[model samples]
Target: MFMRKSKFRHVFGQGLKRDQCYDNIRITKSSWDSRYCDVNPKYVAVITEAAGGGSFLVLPLSKVGRVERDCPLVAGHKAAVLDIAWCPHNDDVIASASEDCTIKIWQIPEGGLTKPLTEPVVDLVAHQRRVSCVKWHPTAHNVLLSAGSDNKIYIWNVGTGEVFTEIDLPDLPLSASFNFNGSKFACTCKDKKLRVYNSRSGECLQEGPGHAGAKPAQVAYLKDGLIFSTGFSRMSERQYALWDEKDLSKAKEMNELDNSNGVIFPLYDADVNMVYLCGKGDSQIRYFEVTDEEPYVHYLNTYQSKESGRGVGFMPKRGLNVNNCEIARIYKLHNSGLCEVIPFTVPRKSELFQDDLYPDTPSDTPALSAEEWFGGKDADPIMVSLKGGFVPTRKDALKVVRRSNVLDKMPTRTSQAQSTNSEAAAAPSLPPKPSTTSTPPDEHVGFDPQGILDDMRKLKLIVKAHERRIKTLEEKLSQYEVNTSEEDEGKA
Candidate 1:
């Protein structure tokens, strides 16, 4: 028998025990094709069903147990929440888009939600139709892109509450993604075409035929100017393909995965060059190794389970268990109101850190600001070492500084033939002002001194907790070294 000699060939999936999972959650019943859940190192947020408006539950990763019926929620939108994404540079920050034709940015507290969060840090109301998707820039601070049913995409600077760029599409976008450095953008549209564009300039770069099916399609930008997409064929058979950005007239490699009707969600790990495909309402996760060779995508193995998942949230690499050789962790949401934690680990007997399985992954640091990115600048993500285990740095609360209303001061248009050039020139020069229009008189204005003091107190407590955990880990590592030395001496 011949076997592949790869470090991840023996990878296995393990589901946590029932007590370790979150139960009694009222997941949303929206028909929207979204993950419905998002996770980070600090918290895991799940879109839940609400009566009057849209709401989602944000729980600390340590609070794994049966949730109460009246748990606190982040409720604000007037409609169902379609998508949610956590900021890559700040674990405490998250963005949510909804059918209310707006997007909201929230900042979760350190100890988790004690009361219902009705107010968002920033309220963006630009889309005329319901917003479908929201994504944060990979390496930029406070930069966000949102897609709406109006056949439009707007890139916003959350810190400033301003639209940095507006891109109009011919059809609705099924999915959108940014390249590794956040310089290029790609999306699959309802017109059955995959379109690539300059993210900043909103210029269409290329367009080609996407999947042949009528169902929704997804696109993910990979390393080295590559793109991966998943959709159905004309016969409704599930299929996947890899494409080169330079030439999208045809896919570099294409293959049919299966005949399942569930939508396949692709999650890519750039460090290991592996992509995991998880189908909605399916009990299996198929993974593949991507390369630059002839067959670009090579199928590995599949992780099968008895229970199917309605949505899945992937944990960042920095949150994995390095001591246990764990490479990936996914939080799968079930129809039975249960959220299960599944860990994928590579088989290894050694107790030491495995550098090959874990490379220098992206850190929680912004490589560019919103102004710089909108000014046509691009930079790679900042990488951090995980040798001694990753310790998250404390970050201050995000501040939103909006410009004054220039529309109120502009002269009224006398005729329809008035040049629009004057209006565009006046927008940028408006003096900056604290956005207190949305807040009540009693509420704290832009930089709240009391809020800062509270945040500092919470950060101090968090630092103390991390220090204690690190000390315990150090002691265990020392004991393991001593035991290994004794065993070696006895063998000699």
Candidate 2:
């Protein structure tokens, strides 16, 4: 286990791996998914969806050194696979959730997925709706959580084909996850609420409203039982909030200034207490270090994705005190269906910079009381916008290019006869310093058909949102109609 000592960790280089899959006979739009399966702290597994519809691919963090292409894993899913997770107890096994409304479990070979999956050992079908998210229990090998359109969270025991419990939430559940200790889990639903539940008892222990008037897309647990959620705000701003699980009345802190234009992807790095936040606003990944004390957010840095539209995952860091904070890497589903594994060497020490670079003074922590924290006329939240959209941390960006060999892969410019090209004519000038409403990495490249499939993903999100709203509104409407009918009968 790598020892984690302090905050001033150095940035490391990322490894590159790619596979241009063209085996499927039926050609349709290309789609991509990404996940980091840590079979061990030293070996992180990365899985990707091949272009069009075929089989899923897997790559190990160790094999990155040999420059071998990613190979397909167990390929039983007849449709595009959506989510993949590694079992906690047995590292060799993995579970996949697909659009086919089924969750398939497979045992990975020691040599890796270089060979075909003759068959999936287990196929569970408990979800009545599309299984959008699938996660393994932190401690239990066969325990899993799958949430989807059914407005419910299902706790399934992979050892048997039975669901241990079902959480029939009032709204559509968006994202769910188990904490490191496995004592509790947190989930976000379409009602803009963050609910923490006991995994064993299957009971809601605590619940809090998040992203007022807007459905929350993702929620994550931080150190000291603090939870973070990202979703839309009533004003359309991408809202990110930090809440204390024990006290759900109000968020310890709330940041609603993300201008990702509705792109709602989020991932948390529990090791360094960092949040790897990415989505519609920029083509890069932004890092925010979570502190243990008040005002728990420290803007760390950002890294641009090599391929246009890719999903991202932070490799699980067991206990490494390396210079670079990141232990493993995964891409966000982006324009290019290409996925790469980034292998980095941690540095000794490093400093952080940000737009609202708060001085490392005592006043950094909020002096406000709990009453002030909630249930009052709150102070205006601080809005910090990095001048050029997602500002890339130079070291991190260079590391990505160096390890990924991105520059070498770019089309070479063969300038043969142009001799008198003016200095002004050359290097056309950077696009008008993008305004505050800067296009997110995903949106910037969203136009590239190869980068993002049909924007069908956006449609799915919107449809889900509408479905939740209708569900809520109809329930209220039915109650009101009943009350009015009762009054009419009394008058008669």
| TM-score for candidate 2 | 0.60
TM-score per prediction, in order, is 0.81, 0.60
Measured over all alpha carbons after superposition, the RMSD of each candidate to the real structure, in angstroms, is 20.8, 22.1
Model 1's alpha-carbon lDDT is 0.82
Q: What is residue 236's positional error in candidate 1, in angstroms?
A: 0.2
lDDT of each: 0.82, 0.53
The C-alpha stretches of model 1 lying farther than 4 A from their native spots are 1-4, 396-492
lDDT value, residue 16 of candidate 2 = 51
Pairs with backbone N, CA or C atoms under 3 Å apart (clashes), candidate 1: none
Candidate 2 Cα misplacement greater than 4 A, ranges: 1-6, 9-54, 62-73, 213-216, 262-264, 305-307, 318-334, 343-346, 349-492
lDDT of 1 by residue, 1-492 (tens): 955456777788888998998999999999888999999988999999999899999999999999999999999899999999998888877899999988988878778999999866656666779999998899877789999998989888675455778899999988999999998889999988998988888999989898999999998899999999999999999999999998889999999988988888898888888888988999988888888876889887889888998998989898889999999988888999999888999989999999999999998877776656777889999898788899875444232222322211111231112223343322322233335797457554486653564344335434543575588699999999999999999999
- The alpha-carbon root-mean-square deviation between model 2 and the true structure, to one decimal in Å, is 22.1
What are the per-residue Cα lDDT tens digits for candidate 2 across 1-492?
943434434444454544432121121133322232233432344344445443555555445423234444557776667677765334455777776677777766655676778455445665666766788755433457887677777776554334566778888777887775555788887787788997666789998877764644677777578888777778777767888889887988887756556455667755446676766425666566688755677665566655543344454433222233334354344344333445443443444332122212111111222112222223221222322222211212211221111111111121111112333222111112233576555565435642132243234434544675588799999999999999999999
